[model samples]
Target: QLIVVFVSILIAFVAYTSQIFVLWNSLGGAVAHTFFVLAPFNVFIIFIYINYALTCTTDPGTVPPNWMPDQNTHFEVKRSTHTARFCKTCNNFKPPRAHHCSTCNRCVLKMDHHCPWINSCVGFENYGHFLRFLVYVEIGSIYLFALLSNRLAQIVEELHTSQIRPSATEATFLSINMIMAALVIICVGILGGYHVYCVTTNTTTIEGWEKGKTLTMKRMGKIQNVKYPYDYGVMNNLRSVLGPQPLFWLWPRTMSGTGLYFPIN
Candidate 1:
């Protein structure tokens, strides 16, 4: 909790403070740079909160107590899929697409992966929030990286030419900002790409490894002709996570779906 809170505040502080340098030196000394910088920066922060709140509060959905398997479902699922669906830990029948997260100590319906960053399990109910968070975070990192690099370059040029000797504090601060941005880009960028691949293929982190195959072996598209069933289509798959409301895809809202039940195909 402390770490999460600290990081959030640090992000906001770094952004606003850095913008001070650019705006202070601009012609007429107006706040244009600061305002422009904060526009996307603030939007990104809003998404961060939205994802964090939803992921933290929403129940990932659990198997009902004393649930019974339908006779038809029993026969249709085949012995292999049906046999492994029971959770010995919970002593309950697991739903299709559900997996037991040892960290959570229970079966999470349509379980993705446990994300410690949000201090929550990113399962059925909160997968959309998690995914959206990744997207916005990656965007924010790249955006900041671009903005800060320009500032850093100017400082570097000044130092190289011996035009002005920068103070230790100013030098350290600028370098740290650029370094942090770079790390965010590399770390969050790769993570965001993986989630994007997951969305396109309808595979989660855990699901990709189970059933004896990693998703890297397969490609997702119209003509793949593979065993990935959850992918309805690109747009429909996106809507499944982002909700059906076109205008609200970027807004803060819970996604549509009963986490307890999902269509496999």
Candidate 2:
């Protein structure tokens, strides 16, 4: 997992370096134009790294040891039973939306998933950082694609107009970088878009799966109904995950919550 993280960072650095090389050497872009283009790109890069580090290092909230729920408190029950949810493996009462992560060998609060790339469970505490990292990666991928496309077009134009061709090394580097950028766009587009939907709907990836299961059971008449209690409409749902202020939605900060309780729809 550490190797994967290191390799991912190295690839990002190489991609950034490749873009600079194409801008200065291959495209021969003007200094002013290059700086203007690189400014926002550099910012996005920094944001990506910052969020990635936070996501990797932050501790997703855990169930306090020897904790138990109040008898009168309404809690998510075990399947069709009214019993409070419990983790047999951890021998503790599981909070709402909490789940035991086999990878981490502990119960996590509102755990979405255990990401191998970061080697951490993304849960209530770190979800904001994870989402921000995805957003930055998506933006960076698109920017890289556009920059590479422009450089390629210029090379083509120069070839046709003056019969001037790029060196073999430059052409090879451009081709490789373009392919990588395209893959990043496709993969991250799907992943980031899915997470965006999850946030807007106030559903984690695990809960999404459980929702599907309940729907299927309802169709078979095995369950009377299915309900997700956390969805508070689109805007409120976004605020639940990204914080209440729209302006700071992109900032690295967790929403206010203990993760043991959540308001219902």
Candidate 3:
């Protein structure tokens, strides 16, 4: 409890007092740059919270349609016979895309890997947060790139004959920022690409790769019950990402023999 409170307070402080905000204020009222840096990050963090609290499935009660059986019976575990290793911390069967962090000793649903930076589990519930975070990260990188590029141009213009001498603080800050920018690019780029690929194929990372063979989704005109085609056309794709209110349980319903029944309210 103490640790949790301390960490939460720390995050609150950083989010409110970070250098990014300082830079935003110092950038001569460049609203575009400020938004470019903050919007994506803000959305991402918000999404994470949503996922963690609302949508991430810690229990494995139902097998989603994406789970496939393999030809090799030896390797293929029957769903009826299968039981996930119970996680004491989570107190539930870790669902697909779920992983238990050694450090936390808890199973996270739709696990993306433990992120120390966020000091939280990245799972299905919080997947939205992760994506939003990535979007922000990408935006932040672009902002930095633009800011640096403009500054570099000015320095070149002024120092045609000599190298610019940076103060110790400036040098350290620049180095750290550059490294952070590179890391963000790589991390966000890979995660975004993976998510995109999964969305197009109508699968999650755990369901797609863990089922022994990759499942290819037919380009169905609409996403499940969504009215529009699942193609990357702006209307269709954006809605899918920033989609309709997700099912309360994060899974959609299907018309059954009797009628439509929604497991989650």
**Which candidate number would show the highest lDDT if scored against the true structure?**
2
Q: Give every collision pair in model 1.
A: none
- After superposition, which runs of candidate 2 have C-alpha atoms over 4 Å from their true positions? 26-30
Candidate 3 TM-score over all chains jointly = 0.49
In what order do the candidates fall by lDDT, top score first? 2, 1, 3
Model 3: per-residue Cα lDDT over 35-145, one tens digit each:
766665555445434443332332212223233323332222235567444445655544434556776666544455555555565544445444554555465565554
Q: Judged by TM-score relative to the true structure, which candidate is superior, 1 or 2?
A: 2
**Which of 1 and 3 is ahead in lDDT?**
1
Candidate 1 versus the native: TM-score?
0.82
The lDDT values for all models are 0.70, 0.86, 0.46
Task: List candidate 1 stretches off by more than 4 Å.
Answer: 20-30, 70-84, 160-162, 211-226
Listed in order, each prediction's TM-score against the native is: 0.82, 0.94, 0.49
Error of 3 at 195 (Å): 1.9
- In candidate 2, clashing pairs total 0
Ordering by TM-score: 2, 1, 3
Tens-digit per-residue lDDT, 36-113, candidate 1: 656777778678767766767788777788665664542124355645367789998777678888888988878898
Residue 76 in candidate 2, Cα distance off native in Å: 1.3
